[model samples]
Target: MFDLIVLSVFNGLIYGLLLFMLSSGLTLIFSMMGVLNFAHASVYMAGAYFAYSLTPYLGFWGALIAAPFLAGLVGAAVERFGLRHVHGHGHVAELLFTFGLAYLIEEFVHLVWGRNPLDQRPPPLLDFPLFTFAGIDFPAFKVFMIVVALGMFVALWLILTRTRIGLIVQAALTHPHTVGNLGHDVPTVFTLVFATGSALAGLAGVMGGIHLVTNPGMAQALGPIVFVVIVVGGLGSLAGALIASILIGLLQTFAIAVDASLADFLRLFGLQVTRATPGWEVWSITLAQIGPMLPYLLLVLMLMLRPRGLLGSRDS
Candidate 1:
């Protein structure tokens, strides 16, 4: 029991951090540019595919470094040629452009990589077990993932809070015309933010491709969940995103592990849950069986109870 609990915690942290990696990029984009990119996950997919194509020649390390820049460049192009043209049309235009752009990216991936999943393996250096405790052997790749995720959080926080560039970026978010008059290239700043956000998503893909899957549909699978993380964490709050990601990660991991049914819960409270009781069918469902439903439920509760989100500073 102890070993199982311990192992589950590490697994939860890994899953949560993967989410943080993905959400952090989206958060950066939204917080800075006020654009909730519908195609953000597609950029993530591009990164994975980019890594898959590059790894054979450059190996994992090289792919890790190169793929993000490639993805960032792609994002920069979208912001410049695609998103930029639509900027005058307002948020609806931006949203529609990104929404359409997502489909375009998916089709491109299908045409290039086909519909099959790519078998991406961890690098040889971090492929083995790192240690064993209470009869549980933890994979080195998983450990590496946790470390990279944490390192990314620290780096992003410092970059945004402690740097001169960060100050200009934040100022631009609120006062673009003033900043532009002050000799800063506001459009260029927007492009950089989009590209950097996409780069962060690409970095997540470089690792997530191996940890999860490298396929065309991979973005579709994780995209909604990433949105949920940011919304629950608050639209533009990095700290909130981190907390929500961890909470959801832990919730889902433990939900999958626990075998208790809703009926068990009612009985625990001396409610005598049985088939004769009202809504017995729903009560009979097991936690593990309904694990995927929990996040949405939490989302609904959050919206009703606190619309601003966990650490949100402004109204959504």
Candidate 2:
């Protein structure tokens, strides 16, 4: 039991940080552009696919760096050519444009990569076990993932809070016209932010593809979860996004570790439901069986109780 607890904690932290990597990019885009960027996860899939294709010639390390740049470049193109044109048509048009773009990107991936999961893996250097706890081995790649995520989080925080560019970005998000009037090229700033956010998503994809599976369906699978993270964290709040990602990650891991069922609750009140019970199907459902749904449940509750989210402000 103690070992299980220890393993669960480690797993939770890993998953949480992985989630933060993805959510941070989405949240940053929202903070700056006020656009939901429905194609965000698709860009992540593109990164994973790009890495897979580049791994043979460039190897894992090269692909890790190159793939994100490719994704970011694509994102910049989409922003410059596609999104900018749709901006004057209102938010709905922009949202619909991205929604369509996501499908196009997915189809393009399917055409190129096919309907299959790639055999993506970490480099041999990072594949070995880092440590063993209670007879269970922890992989070095997970530690690397943790480091990358923390580095990104800290770097982003510093860039936003301590730099001149950061100040300009914050100001632009709130007042694009004002910044433009100051001759700072506000449009260029927005383009860079979109590209940077997409690049971060790409980086996350490269790391996560090895950690999870690199399937063509990967984007669609993770799309809802990413949205849930940002929404629960507070739409445009970076700190809120981080806290919510970790919270949801821990919640999912811990919930799956427990073997409790609704039937267990009935027994506590001197009532028991057996297989023969009329509602046995429902009562026998274990928490682990529905762990994936926990985040959505929390999302609904958060929306109902505190729509602004944990760290969100009135305007956020």
Candidate 3:
């Protein structure tokens, strides 16, 4: 049981870190531009579909290289054309525009990829198990996922902290007017940040497509969950996003791995309730049944208790 718990925690950490990859970009864009990108997850879905189409001809690695570039280009175009035009309309308009873009992307994906789940698999090299502990096997693909996520995290940290570009980005996030006064092209910086964020989403989509099933509805399915992560992690705070993502990931993983029921609680208290008894249904609740809602539940609790989020400077 202890081993199982450890394994579940590890798996959760992997998922959370992947989520952070997507959320970090989002938080940065939000901090710098003050826009909540509703279409971010849709771009992620596009990455998956783009990879799927590319895999038949170019293979997984090729798709991995090309899909994110294409997605980033798309993001840049959207910012240059669509967002730039809409920026004058205020924050609500910007958000609505993104929401509309999300809907359009969903429909476009259905039209192009069809309204069905596509079978996506990792490269043949990643098909086997990496190792086993306490008689439980861990797949090589999952290990690869952890490595890739960690590498991205380290690279991103270095770029944001060590380079001139990173310094400019940080300044833009906190003092955009000052940066602009100093002759930096603030709009250009914003566009680049938006594109970079989209690229990160694309990377997550490609990895998730290989790990999870890909379908036309995948965007809509995961969209709210990502939003919850952003809100729970605190708006515009990358560190908060990292913490929230891992917290939600582990909470869900452990919730599903455990098997205890609410009935166990009643028994411990020397109380009993029949199936037909009023309020007795609580006794029938199982961990698995509630596991899926764990993230949302955490989001609600966090919002209620700390509106600014764990590390956020402002309310989401």
Candidate 4:
């Protein structure tokens, strides 16, 4: 029992960190630019594909370094040529544009990569087991994911709170004219923020393509969860996003790890429901079956109890 729980904790940490890698980028875009980029996950998918395509030419290491940068450049171009044109039309327009862009990006991926999931395995250098705990071996690749996520989190916090460029980026949305008067280009800042956010997503993709699945449906699978993380953490709060990511990650891990069913849950309280009992159909279900739906459930509960999220400000 203890071993199962321990294993679950480790799994939860890895899952949570992965969520952070994706959510942090979304959070940065939202908090800095005030744009709810619907295509963020699509960009992440593009990054994964970008890395995959580059691997043959550059090898895994080169692709890993280059793909995110390429993704960033693509993001900058989108903001400059596509999104900026729609910026004048208000948030609804921005949302619609990005939402459409997401579909377009998905179709493009499908047309180019086909519907099959890529055979994107972890690089040979990091494929071995790093350690064993609770009789389960943890992979080095997953440990790398954890380290990268943590390093990015710390680095982002420092850059945002302690750096001059961070100050300018943060202020650009709230005080554009003021920033412009100070000799900074507000539009350029917005482009940089979008690119940076996309780059973060791309970075996540480079690792996540292997950590998770790399497929055409990859963006659709994760897009909603990223939004959930951001909303649960707070609309524009990076710290909130991180906390929510871990919470959701742990919640999901435990749900899938536990062997208890609704029937077992009742038996724990000396109550047993047989096949003839009322709602047997429901009671027969196991928590592992509920794993996929847990995040949305938490999302609903979060909205009801505290709509702003775990660490969101009242105004946010």
Best-matching candidate per lDDT: 1
Q: Write the per-residue lDDT of candidate 3 for residues 1-316, one digit (tens) a residue.
A: 8789879988898778778878888888887768888899899999999999999999999998788888899889999999989998899999999999999999999899899899999999999999988777889988888888778778877888899888888889878999999999988988898898898889888988888888877777777777778888887777778888888889888988888788776778887766876876677888878998888887888888997788886655
Candidate 1 regions with alpha-carbon error over 4 angstroms: 174-178, 276-278
lDDT of 1 by residue, 1-316 (tens): 8987997798889999988988987876776556779999999999999999999999999999999999999989998998889988888989888999999999999999999999999999999999998899999999998999899889887877899887777677566789989998889888998898899899889998999999998888878888889879986677888999999999999999999998998888898988998898899999999899888888889989998789876566
**Decreasing lDDT order of the candidates:** 1, 2, 4, 3
The per-prediction CA RMSD against the true structure, in angstroms, equals: 1.7, 1.7, 1.7, 1.8
lDDT: worst 10-residue window of model 1: 27-36
lDDT of 2 by residue, 132-217 (tens): 98988999999999899889988988998899888888777667789889889888888898898889889988988999889888
CA deviation > 4 Å runs, candidate 4: 173-183, 314-316
Q: What TM-score should be assigned to candidate 2?
A: 0.94
**Backbone collision tally, model 1:** 0
Give per-residue lDDT, candidate 2, residue 248. Answer: 86
Off by over 4 Å in 3: none
lDDT of each: 0.88, 0.87, 0.85, 0.86
Which regions of candidate 2 fall more than 4 Å away from where they truly are?
A: 181-183, 276-278, 314-316
RMSD of candidate 4 to the truth, in angstroms, is: 1.8
